[model samples]
Target: MAKYVAPAISLSPFTCPACGAYAQQIWAHAIYVQPHANTNYDVAPLRRCKCASCQAYSFWSKETEAQIFPRAVASPMPHPDLPENCAAVYLEARNVVGDSSKAAAALLRLCVQHLLVHLGGKGKNLDDDIAKLVKEGLAVQVKDALDICRVVGNNAVHPGEINLDDDPAMAGQLFELINFIVRETIERQKRLAEMVDRLPQGARDAIAKRDAKALNGLA
Candidate 1:
């Protein structure tokens, strides 16, 4: 997975926001001059940068040094342990966030639903599924994160209290929340199971027996 880093300087090596490749960005400034009736007009100067690794081009304003092309936004890469289906939707959301935050929020909401389903949710209503997971001892922080996505996503799709049209930052936050959910639920549990499996067989059996006795009120 690609780690996102903000480009600091024009000619320095930084992660390519377009393809997430870390490479040297070659920078050049160009100002187009248009002449009419013995008069020359200079257009706004733009700094062009090309990534050495991916050969992708990005434009920046010469004066402000702000990214122009590709509409720079800080979005995290999908978690390594995220399910393939959820990751696909997450990427889709990231792709359109710069254009339409409402659409991105809606896609993230869909990703959240898919993630819950992968975690044994019933594949029905999202609210009901979240409630069930909370009842099943989902972490308080995880539940809260899920609810934030759920509410924002809901508002994105339907006419709701929150307006997502002007809030790309909030939409960006949903990406991190989705990854956090995957880490808390899937990755943590998988790591715990792997640790348990690495224990000696005798120790594993002893733990099973202890758990059984505890369930049976004999511990």
Candidate 2:
């Protein structure tokens, strides 16, 4: 029996997909040192990594330079208002976006539905849910864009609802639209909270007074 040690795995360049963090730790190694005529590399090593930010585990193969299994990372979202299930679904969608556009699109559509439900919007289907968001004050332009996502997602899941090209670019657009909506709602609230927290005592009192008066219908 012989003891084997792999060189420290580089956490640079490759980002942890789950947490959007650059830091990682390797806990195990599998290395193959056989000479091969098919490949140029002399050694093949597979390293197990745990992201420092999210503590999620992934295995990295040196030859492929990629996480071989669970190929998708759970990258952090900008919006605190996004539900946990939606975030997880978004990550899964992102992971498959490069390989399967239809699957990603369907998951992204589900993400939108989860977000709408989390935000107190309800409907029998994704289209109705999106309409509920518009009724709740979502901008018309955003609603129009979301409707496109709804249709695309429906096409992906049901097939032939619409003639879809099934391209990665279209999947990317759905992902981006969901992110935009989350940031617009969740991050905006966080920023506003931060601003209120930084206000001067006198300003805070004045704002509170105004709010109280408004609530009492006296303002």
Candidate 3:
């Protein structure tokens, strides 16, 4: 049995798994310290927190000085390179991967869709969407990799298609592919923007002039 405890003086803000919102005003509605006869660090409290943004509740447990462990949201933080829509769907897929592989795969497919849209790709389906990326200057290898993910997700969601088993290894592979795409696409743009920001004003103006001339076919 565990004993209830008053929450510590300072409660740090954490992201909520339910709504994918960063919540600062998390109130510990209930907290219980687990019974531990061995270690001093076993003083970690189990807590239920309510998010102000979405008004959704989440659970937290297992604290370390270096790391804060909240329920499903802890293992993998949403990628900074992912767009908001893709990140939300990616997190949803992660949350349910253990219970339903098919559902998770469907959510992952949506993530791919969001990514494609972010890249200004168009298609009637995911395959065409991937092909559009290739036409728009994405590397062939990356497009091929994304195609495989799309195939798996498509099979998982189809009515008569064979169901994908809840395989952790397979899920991990899909996530790895998604992470790579995000880095290659969004992160590259971020780096370029940062580099542009650091350029000298004269160099920036010169580039702008060159671009304008090219646009006007006067270069």
Q: Count the backbone clashes (under 3 Å) in each candidate.
A: 0, 2, 0
* Residues 1-219 of candidate 2: C-alpha lDDT, one tens digit per residue: 011122234553245555554554545565444576444432337777666667877777777666676654332332345668888888788777777788888988888888777666773587777766777788776687778788888888886655445355776678667767766776677789999999999999999999998999963
Model 1 per-residue lDDT tens digits across residues 93-192:
9889888899999999999999999887876788899999989898999999999999999999899888887566899899989988988989899999
Root-mean-square deviation (CA) per prediction: 5.6, 8.5, 9.4
Count of clashing pairs, candidate 3: 0
Q: What do the candidate models score in CA lDDT, each in turn?
A: 0.84, 0.67, 0.66
Candidate 2 TM-score, true structure as reference: 0.64
Q: Highest TM-score: which candidate? A: 1
Top lDDT prediction, candidate number: 1
Residue 122, candidate 3: Cα error in Å is: 3.7
Q: How well does each candidate superpose onto the true structure, as a TM-score?
A: 0.75, 0.64, 0.63
Query: What's the true lDDT of residue 36 in model 3?
Result: 67
Model 3 weakest lDDT span, ten residues long:
1-10
Model 1, residue 113: distance off in Å is: 0.5
